[model samples]
Target chain A: MRDVAIVAFAQSNCQRDAGAQNEVELIMPVLTEVFKQTGIKSAQDVDFTCSGSCDYQQGAAFAFVAGVDALGAVPPIKESHVEMDAAWALYEAWLKIQMGSAESALLYGFGKSSPGELPIVLSQQLDPYYLAPLWVDTIAFAAMQARTMLDSGEITEADMAEVVARSRNNALKNPHAQLKGDQTVADLLKEATYVSPLRRHDCCPISDGACAMIICTIEKAEEWGKPYAIIKGIDHRIETHHIGSRDLSRSVSTEIAGKAAGVANGPVDVAELYAPFSHQEIILKKALGLGDDTVINPSGGVLAGNVMMASGLSRIGEVAMRIIRGEAKRGVAHATSGPCLQQNLITVLEAK
Target chain B: MAQLAAVVGVGQTKYKTKRKDVSIAGMVREAAVNALEDAGLTWNDIDAVIIGKAPDMFEGVIMPELYLTDALGCNGKPMLRVHTAGSVGGSTAIVAATYVQSGVFKRILTVSFEKQSESNAMWALSNPQPFSPHLNAGAGGYFAPIIREYMRRSNAPYDAGIKVAVKDRLHGAKNPLAHLQLPEITMKEVEDSPMLWEPLRFLEACPSSDGACAMVIANEELAAKSPRKPAWIRGAAMRSEPTMYAGREQVNPRAGIDCAKDVYAQAGIHNPRKDLDCAEVYVPFSWYEPMWLENLGFADEGKGWELTMSGATSLTEGGDIPWNPSGGVLCSNPIGASGMIRFAEAAQQVRGEAGDHQVDGAKTALGHAYGGGAQFYSMWVVSSEKA
Candidate 1:
């Protein structure tokens, strides 16, 4: 396999609501920043382009088609789309690079989460024949998982508050974070509950954002002389559609994808997880078997800015940037889709 | 280099206006079972499943693959869903092939389908939303101006569009699975038909269809062990651009040209008109037959209409490059499955299984599909001989 590396990455700031901009407007800045970093003049220089976006988010079908204009596709360029997280777009670009079909690939993902009621919109992802008809919102779904953990004596309400405290403090350092403050666990415990035992701090705010990344072979990475983040391994898996069919306390998909991605082989120095809700981060850390010494979500994570589709790839871009700047040697990035992480993808990246 | 991929088995449901006789799951299963049977394998032999479609609104099922996991026999394996407008069928197959080419999976199952009968396609296509102009006009309304431009640039006769409608309809008569099979269609009948859009008569447009198409792709080891003949994928390519921009040319789209060039180069075909035996292109409208002939390099610009008028696209005629021998989208169009049918028909011709619509001694076949205001394109070349 040819050695593929992440050469460039950029993203628009996560906002609670960017009413003036649509998806296309939100993506223009990200595309410009990525190109400016590489010094490439034309879209033709990029051999392959791929994007990740959802029709539901934009409230329109084929919404991503307008994104092509940001790349200035005048003579037309080789491209593809995935109705998935932008991270998968990066994965497809990586495979194209590995095949030697394209020397360089550009990947982008965007979402406008503020357009609709997220909890209501997310319910549509459930088993439409059964669960969706009930109209059980996403918070209520997460509440069930939290209740299961509480009943099993695995965690307490105070433990959840501590998680909120730590995440909010971490977000204070991130300029793009939508939620950031300095508060203690005691302070969070006194907050009113939004979904019984799950306070407002436990849930991430609805955010609008976009992200872009560039991938190239190791030879090309050196030719360009940019700090490189090598994708060591990647895998994804899905569970039964019915939330009740599987154990809510555990994520079988994460375990499967993690094992396939060789999560146990070497020491993981850092972890960036796509956990929109607080308890999900706890569940993911346990599933990944991270040690206490391993740092997690130093960039405030999704708890600070959950931009739906783009948030997942932004986690990857953030970790790659850390390695590109000589901050970390090895890291793991995780992305999830569906209610309560029914589907999961794991990628291991290394700086060599 | 990676192990080359080949289509060991191919399957498709009967093209029709509506397959209400079966549910969406049943429609996909029909094609999947046929492909597995053709390969002499079972669901257990498959490693993963990749499925795609134009939009979830077509069936009122958002991410329907989740509901279809059990029906597709992909519960315990990895299943991926790709959506890239109408070209998704071809892109879905290419993604599955990549798994084998990347040495990840040995045998992969790829399928794409559309149950247009479930919902009104015209309404679903024109759903109004925020921050976008309402496309109240249907596909014909969107494509009329481009057709007018093609006529002006080519300086073709007014009867040229009618000739295409007559030719493909006559060709549809030979295929049993076609949706619109008129045994005796005439140029006068087409010309006199109600005009839905200027430069395009009602008969010149493809019918709304309900159908599915599937294939089983495998690596070298499993491909060599297949019971039936295999159509080696000589080349495959996909390209896309913005739907509209300040200076974008809608008449002769560059996306089509770039995609064709990429695939032709990979297939080592310097002169498509002379090297290719036949082509199954996406012609939802009759005029697209000639437009694509020029875009795909099968004929020179401003002369594609001449090729269609000279009876060169007929299977029985001694034409340089016979086009749409299996009736094509003009006769049968299940929006999502239409693209895969082009792919399956190409494989069928190279495998020598196309009974009545077979092009004599067809060795090289082109499968093409485009969508979204002609901004997206997917093309592939299959050969009887391995590259």
Candidate 2:
């Protein structure tokens, strides 16, 4: 396979509501930032462009079509879109490069989650015949998983509280985080339960945001003279969609994808995981076999600020940025979709 | 160099106004199972699954792939969902091909579907945005002006669209799975149909359909061992421009032109009309047939209508280069699946499996689909023999 690297990454600050700012407006700033970092004029410079987003975020069909307006795609460009997280968009772009179809690619993901009842909107992702008709929201599903873990002695409420405490403290250094603060584990544990055994702080905030990344062949990275992180391996796996079919406390797909992505090939210095619920971070850590040496969620992860379609890509961006800045030598980034992480992707990045 | 890929199996659910007998998962499974049966493989033999659809709102399901994992047998495997508007079907097929072409997976199952009976597509497409004008009601309302511009620039005969409608419907009659089997449809009948949009009559527009299309793509190694002949993928390309921009050519969009040029060049076709044996271009409206013919290099600008008038694009009429021999979007438009149906039909022609709609001795064919105000385009060329 041709050597590929993430050369630049940029994202908008997570907001409770990006009022009146449409998808194009939410995306343009990040696009400009990535271009500035790469010293490129527009998407015209890239061999391919792809994006990931959902129409339900805007309450309309084909909502992603508006995002092209931000790219200045006037001369016509090779492009595609996925109704998925941008991390998968990166995967598609990587495949294009692997097939010798493109030398470089520009990819982005965006979402306005504050417009709708985020959890209810996400419930539609469940099995239509069995679960979606009941409108079992996302938080309710996560709570059930948390309950399962607690009852099985896999984790304690204090452990979940500690994850939330650390996430909040870590987000203090992340300017783009939507939820951040210096809070003690005891303080978090004191919060009233929003759902049985789960507090409001345990769930990620609904935020509107966009993120962009530029990837290219290692040769192009050197030619551009930008500090970059090589993508060593990337793979994704999906589990059965039936919520009752699998163990709710463990992420089987994550383990499969992590193994496939070669996460254990090297020592992980930093790990950024898309764990919308605080307990999921613990679940992913165990699945990936990360040790105490790994600095997990240095950017507070999605628990601090989840941007829906963009958050998955952000996990990857966080790890790549750490490597580019010489703060970490190797890292693992993970993204998830579906209730209780039915689908999971693992990307391993290393510094040059 | 990229690995070679081929379509070893193709399957599609019967196009219809509503598939009342099956649920969404059952409907999609039918196509996937048919494809697997054609490939002489089971669900476990596939390496990955990639699905595509126009929008989540169309079925009131957000990212339906999450729920479809079991139906497609994607458990413990990589699955990707693509959504590129109307071109999603063709784009999804290309993505599946890339998995094999990139040497990432040996065999991939790709599916595209739309169950329009579950929700109102017209309403889903016509949602009012905050700043965008709500003047256009549905797709027809939006494309009527573009069609009018094409008519004025080409100065084509008014009967040109009527001729295409009758021709494609007649072709549809030969395909048992097609939604509209208008065996006796005539130009005179089309002319008398009610006009929904100017220059577009009821019969000239595509019907709303519920359907799914699927294909099993494999590497050259696996394809060679297949029980049936394979359609070798010659080339694939996609292009996109902003939906609207200053001085954009809506009648003959640059995206479609560039996409065709790139794919033809990859397929080593210097002249599309002479090289490609047949084509299955997306023509949701009849007038788009001639407009795309010119854009796709089948004919010179302003002369595509002459080819239509000469019956050069008709299969039953013994045309040298037939278009949509298995009917087309105008006969069975399941929105998202429409594009892949075009692509699969093209492959069928090359594989000599198109049954009654077969273009005689077709060795090479082209499949094309466009979406999002004609700004997004996906096209591929397939040949019976490997290059």
Candidate 3:
């Protein structure tokens, strides 16, 4: 495989409601930041460009097409888009580089989840004939999964609270994080359940934001003289979509993808996981076989602020940033789609 | 150099206004199973699945791939969902081909579909948004002015679009799966049809369709071992520009020209009209035929209508360079699947498996698709021989 590395990454400050800002407005700032970081004037500098976004977040069809305006895609450029998270867009760009179709790529993901009923909008992702018509929102599905873990003695209410408390504490240092505080596990446990077993703190806050990243062949990174994080391995796997068909207490897809991504190839200094719920962080940590040796979610992860499509790519950027900043030598970044962790992607990054 | 890949198998569902006999999952599976069967393989042979469609609103199903994992045999494998407006089908196929060309996976199953019957596409496409003009009235309403501009610039005959509608419908008659099979269609019928958009008549527009298209792309090693001949992928290119921008040329988009040039260059073709055996281009409205003919270099600007008037783009007319032998988007437009149908039909031509709509002794062909006010373009060149 051709060597590829993430040399630049930028993201908007996660906002609970980016009032009146359209999709293009939410995306332009991050695109400008990434361009500034990489010294590239516009998307025209990259060999290829790809994006990830969902239209439901904006309550409009073909909403992502507007994102092109943020890139100033004049004279045309090789570009593609995915309905999934931007991490998958990154994967597509990586494949392009691997195929020698491009030496460098620009990718981004954005969402205006605050414009609509975020959880209810996510219900449309379920089985259209069965689950979607019933309108079982995303929180209900995650709540059921958390209840399964509680009933199976796999986790306790305190365990979930502890995860939330850590996320709140870690997020205090992340300026872009929307939710942050020094709340303790005891304080979080006192909060009433928002959906039976899942408390408000246990769930990730719906956020409106965008993130952009620039990756290139190792040679290109050297030519730019930028600090970079080498992408050693990346792979994704999906489980059966039926909620009853799989074990909710365990993230089988995450385990499979983590293994395939070579997560255990060496010591992981840190890991950034896109676990929207507090209990999911525990499920993912166990699934990836990370011990106390690996610091998890130093940037507070999505539980601090979840920007739908952008959250997944932000997880990857968080890990790569740590490696590039010399805060960590190696790390694992995970991105998940579908309810109950039905699909999972693991990307391993290491410092040069 | 990147590893080579080829289209070893192709399958498409019978186009219709509504496929009531099957669910969305069933419709996609039918095409996938057909493609797998054509490749003489099974579900286990595919390493990954890449699916594409226009928008979640078109079917009221958000990210349908999540619910379709089992139907596509994508469980425990990588599944990528591509959405690039109307050009997504072709983009999805290209993404699948890259899985092999990148040497990450050997066999990839790529599918694009639209079950427009589940919801109203016209309403979904024209949903009002803040600060945006509400003047948009579906795709035809947007393209009619562009077509009018082409006619004004070229001074082409008023009947140029009518002829194209007649010719493509005739071609659609030969393909059993096409949604519209108007074997007896005439220019008079098209010209007399209700004018939906100024120059574009009701008959000149493509029907809203419910269907799916699938293809199995494989690495050179696996493609060579396939039971049937493979259409070697000589080149694939995709280009995109902002939908509305100052000084943007909507009549003949620069993205279309650049994409065609890039793919042709990769295929080692200097003159598209002579180097290509045939083309299956996206033509939802009849007037786009001549407009794209110029954009794709089949004819020079202001002269594309001349080629159309001469029957150079008609298969039954014994034209040297026929376009859309299997009818194309004009006959069967499932929005998302429309682009891949062009791509798959191009492969069928080179593979000598197009049956009744087969181009004679076709060894090289071009598949083209454009979307979003013609600002997005995807094109690929395929040949019988490997480079």
Candidate 4:
């Protein structure tokens, strides 16, 4: 594969309510910032542009078409869209570069989950015939997974609380984080469960925001004169849609994707895992087999602010930023979709 | 150098106003299974799966590919969903081919579909946005003005669109899978149709359809093993421009022009009219047939109508070039799947498997799709010969 690198990254502040702002407004600032950071004058400066977003987030067909208005695509730019997290969008961009179709690409993702009841909205993502009619929200699925782990003696409620505790502590350093505090595991465990074993704090916030990143062939990054992180490997895998067919406590897809991504080839100095729920982080970490030396979610991960489609790409950006800032040398970023992590993407980034 | 990719198999579910017998998942699997069977491969042969559809609202299912994991044999495999307006079907196919072209996956399953039966497409498409104008113009209302502008600019004959509607329906008569099969359609019949959007009669506008298209794309090595003749992808390109920007020509979008130019450049074609055997251009509206002929450089500006009038785009043996031999989007449009049908039809023509609608001895063909207020465009050139 060609040497693809992340040259720049920018994001909007995670907010509970964007307050009358539409998707285009949520996306424009970050797109403008990434272009400015890369020193590229406009959207035309990039060889390609791709975005990741969900139409269901706004309850409209072809809703993502509006997001393109922010790109100022007057002269027409090579572009595509993914109904997925921006992390997958990044993967598509990487593929374009590897195929020699493009040298530089700008990718972004956005979502506004506050307008509707998020869990109810997410219920629509389930299988229309079997699960959606039940209104089986995302949290309910996570709760089932957590309960399975608890019943199987695989993890404790306190363990899930610790994940939240650490996330809160780490999010304190992230300016864009929506929820951050210095809470301890003991305090979190004391809180009542909102759904059986899963507590209110165990869930990621319903944030409305967008994120943008610019990547290029290493040669193009050099010409752009910017610090960058090499994307050493990336892969994604999905599990069966039938929940009954999957092992709820284990992330088989993440493990397969992680191994394919070469997550074990080198020491991971930092990692950003997109586990929207607390217990899924434990599931992902064990699947990835990360060591204690790796700093997990220094940018607080999605629990600080779950920007829906943007959260996964944000995880990748967080790891890339740490590597670029000399805070780490190598890292693995992860993103998940569907109920109970039916699909997962793993990306490895390293300082050149 | 990028690895060459080829389409070893192509399949489509019957294009109809609604396939009420099957569920959405069942309908998609029909196409995928047909494609795999055509490739003479099983589910285990595919390395990855990529699916595309316009929007979740159309089916009332967000990211329906997730629900279709098992249906497409994507479990424990890499899967991605693409959405790029009406161009999504073409873009999805391109993404699947890229995986093969990048040497990441040797064989991939790509599918695109729309189940208009699940909901009202026009109502779903007309949903109001927060900041956008509330003109309440659905897709046809939005495009009619653009079609009018094309006529004004080119000073084309008023009968040009009616001719397209009749011609494509006649082609549809040859394909059993097509939604509209008016074997004896005539100019009078089309002209007698009600004018829904001024110059565009109801017959001139594409019918809403429920269908799916699937293709199996493989690298050269894997394609060589296939029993079927492969349609080698010579070049693929996609372009997008902002909506409502000043200087943006809605009629002849620059994105469409640039996309065609890029793909043609890669394919080493200087004259689309001469080099391409036929084209499966996306023409949800009849006028788009001529409009895109100019935009794709098949004819000079203002002369696309002349090409149509001269019968250059007829499917019969007398025509120099053919367009939409598979009846195309105007005859059977399932929105998301319409673009892939165009791509798949082109591949089929080059592979000499287009049956009755086949352009005789077709060696090279073009597949094109555009979307979103004419701002998004995707095109590909495929040939019987290797890239």
Kindly report which residue stretches of model 2 are placed more than 4 angstroms away from their true locations once superposed.
Answer: none
Please write out the lDDT profile of model 3 over residues A1-352, one tens digit for every residue.
6668999999999999999998889998898898899988999999999999999899989899889988888989999999999999999999999999999999999999887898999998999998999999999999999999899998999999999899999999999999999999999888998998999999999999999999999999989888899999999999899999888888888998999889999999999999999999999999999999999999998888999998999999999999989999999999999998999999999998
- Model 1 lDDT per residue over A1-352, tens place: 5567888899888899889697769988888888878777656788899888888777777777777778788777888888888887877777677666778988999998777888898777665556778888888988888888889998899888777788789889888888889899989888899898688989888889899988888888888787789888887777777766778878877887888888888988889988877888889988888888778898888888888888888888888999888888999999887778877788888997
Q: Candidate 3 regions off by >4 Å? A: none
lDDT of each: 0.84, 0.93, 0.93, 0.91
Q: Report the lDDT of model 3 for residue A99.
A: 91
- What is the TM-score of each predicted model, taking all chains together? 0.96, 0.99, 0.99, 0.99
Candidate 4 regions off by >4 Å?
A: none
Give the clashing residue pairs of candidate 4, or none: none
i-RMS, every candidate?
1.8, 0.8, 0.7, 0.9
Q: Report the C-alpha displacement of residue B232, candidate 1, in angstroms.
A: 0.8
**Residues A255-283, candidate 4, lDDT per residue (tens digit)?**
99999999999999999999999999999
Q: What is the iRMSD in Å for candidate 3?
A: 0.7
The digit string of per-residue lDDT tens for model 1 on B132-223 reads 77888778888988989999999988887787787777778988888898988988899889999897889999999998899999988899
lDDT of 4 at B228: 89
Q: Each predicted complex: what DockQ?
A: 0.51, 0.88, 0.90, 0.85
Q: Which is the leading candidate under DockQ?
A: 3
